[model samples]
Target: MMRVLAIGDIHGGLKALVQLLNKLEIKDGDTLIFMGDYVDGWSESAQVIQFLIELSEKINCIFIKGNHDVWCEEWLRDGSVDMTWYIHGGKETMESYSGFSKEDKQKHLAFFENLKMYHLDNKNRLFLHAGFTSMHGVEKEVFQTTLYFDRTLWEMALTMDKSIERDSELFPKRLTHYHEIYIGHTPTTNFGVEKPMNATNVWNVDTGAAFKGKLTAMDVETKSFWQSDNLPCLYPNEKGRNKD
Candidate 1:
């Protein structure tokens, strides 16, 4: 059977991503869905994109755009820079592209330009970089930013009393419609886990790779997973963003 994997934010952690991919044992027939935020954070943004491009030639891959990725894409496409992104992880992402030729840079930009905001898999699962405001179809076109920044959904899930049957008055219909929703903007490390964190029907795969945690990947069919060593350890001498 073909494996389906969902990966979380890479945050330019090339070494960490390389190690995790090795552990994932990816095959040509497998389908991979990346949760995005591929650039900004660590110092290897260019290298990370290089790896993704190579990986695509061998396997089917879905790339979702995260807020950080949008900022980086803007910089690459028009020399536009956002100070907020720079203050967080954009500076490193820009620096990583300093040595690349224009052609190489354009190739990576094309990859960014083509990213999806969300992906619905064959198994009735929704894959995205962040939470969403509603399951209503039009929300994606109206409040697209919510798709990459909302957190109320996670908060609602966390507070639900699972022991009680879901009350439509209480439990959101949008969340229950999907068999599963996989997201990555909020790192599981914030919930104190170094692996994927499950809350209700949503799985937060981001293990804070942009910070001090690992880059994570999981097999949807088997519920099996792989992770890299603490990202800070992977780049010992480099201080990623505000890691002080």
Candidate 2:
């Protein structure tokens, strides 16, 4: 009965993201679940983060760390590592907060570090930044790295034996254990290529907001989806290489 509005990768598309949220007109009892990658790619990383932080005060918001977030964390921790992050739109994120005080930087870092890996809703739904892997014991032994980088589980999910009870009381697969699993990362194209079985237990919302795709969001209870057309990249992909 919890109406959760789950948004996919924002990739710093602040305008598009804002429009999408405005369209939703979030109300009380509705939760906003961000699947991470809040910074990088687009031109308004800092603004987007600031907006989401403020929005969190009004609504029930849960943030899950994505790969880009991990990189941002590292960049903030070490000022000298800017080059390593700039390539993947990190420069824009830094530029967004170029005039911020040292205190501001510390606050942002704390927010990033505090992101949760996953959220479970009364055993009916699961929200995670990335898919899980068997090596990590599905829902039992979750690691920070696995939550952000585990693609192997996505591959295995495709081959899940249909004969087994999807929601079996015993061997509970992550997806099967919950009524539905919401995830971001492993682009839809990758999911199509890796999972040809048409697995329906999991839902992938990451529409490649940073690439030549769209920014997407899904209404958990309604199962309705919304998207915004791809935005122009601030820097050419080639020129922004993180060679540091």
Candidate 3:
């Protein structure tokens, strides 16, 4: 049977990503859904993108756009750099591409440009980098940034009374549209959890690879997951996003 795995934010931890994939023992029929933030944080941001591009040639992969990707894409498209991004790990990302040729950067730019903001699978499961606000679902979301930046959806799910049924008016309408939602952005480590976390029907897979946590991936059907050793351990000389 084919397995669908939802991977969390990479945040330039290419070493961790590789280790996790090796543990997964990925096969021909597996579908990998990446939850964005592929760059910025560690010293291998550029290398991570290069690897993902190559991996796509041999395996099925779906890439979602995240806030950090937006910053990198803008910089790649032009010379513009968001000061906020620079302070928050963008400097490492920029430094990671120091030796790449202009043509190579263009290819990476195209990859980012082609990423999807959200994906809805045949099973009514939604995969996105972050949250959406519209009660009508992702399609009706008026603000594009909210799709990759909003945390309200997850926050609501986390705080909602578990006893509240979907039919209850007290339940969040925004969540009722999908059978399940998989997202990344807010690190589960922030809540003291080192593994994938489920709040109501939303699964937060970002186990904080950008910080002191590990890179994570989950089999969506079984919720079985695999993780790499803590990113800090993999790059002991580097600070990652922990400097922030």
Q: What are the Cα lDDT values of the candidates?
A: 0.86, 0.72, 0.96
Q: Candidates 1 and 2: which is better by TM-score? A: 1
Model 3 TM-score relative to the real fold: 0.99
Candidates, ranked, lDDT = 3, 1, 2
- List, residue by residue over 143-168, the lDDT tens digit for candidate 2: 66888777665566666676767556
Residue runs of model 3 more than 4 Å from their true location after superposition: none
| Model 1 poorest ten-residue lDDT run | 133-142
Model 3: per-residue Cα lDDT over 1-244, one tens digit each: 7999999999999999999999999999999999999999989999999999999999999999999999999999998999999999999999999999999999999999999999999999999999999999999999999999999998988998999998899888889999999999999999999999998899999999999999999999999999999999999999999964
TM-score list, all predictions: 0.95, 0.82, 0.99
Off by over 4 Å in 1: 135-141, 166-169
C-alpha lDDT of residue 103 in model 2: 84
Error of 1 at 96 (Å): 0.4
Residues 1-244 of candidate 1: C-alpha lDDT, one tens digit per residue: 8899999999999999889888878777888999989988889999999889998988899999999989988988999989999889988898898789999999999999999999987788889888877655324436888888888777877777777555556667767667888999987778788989887888888989998888989998778888899988989888785456
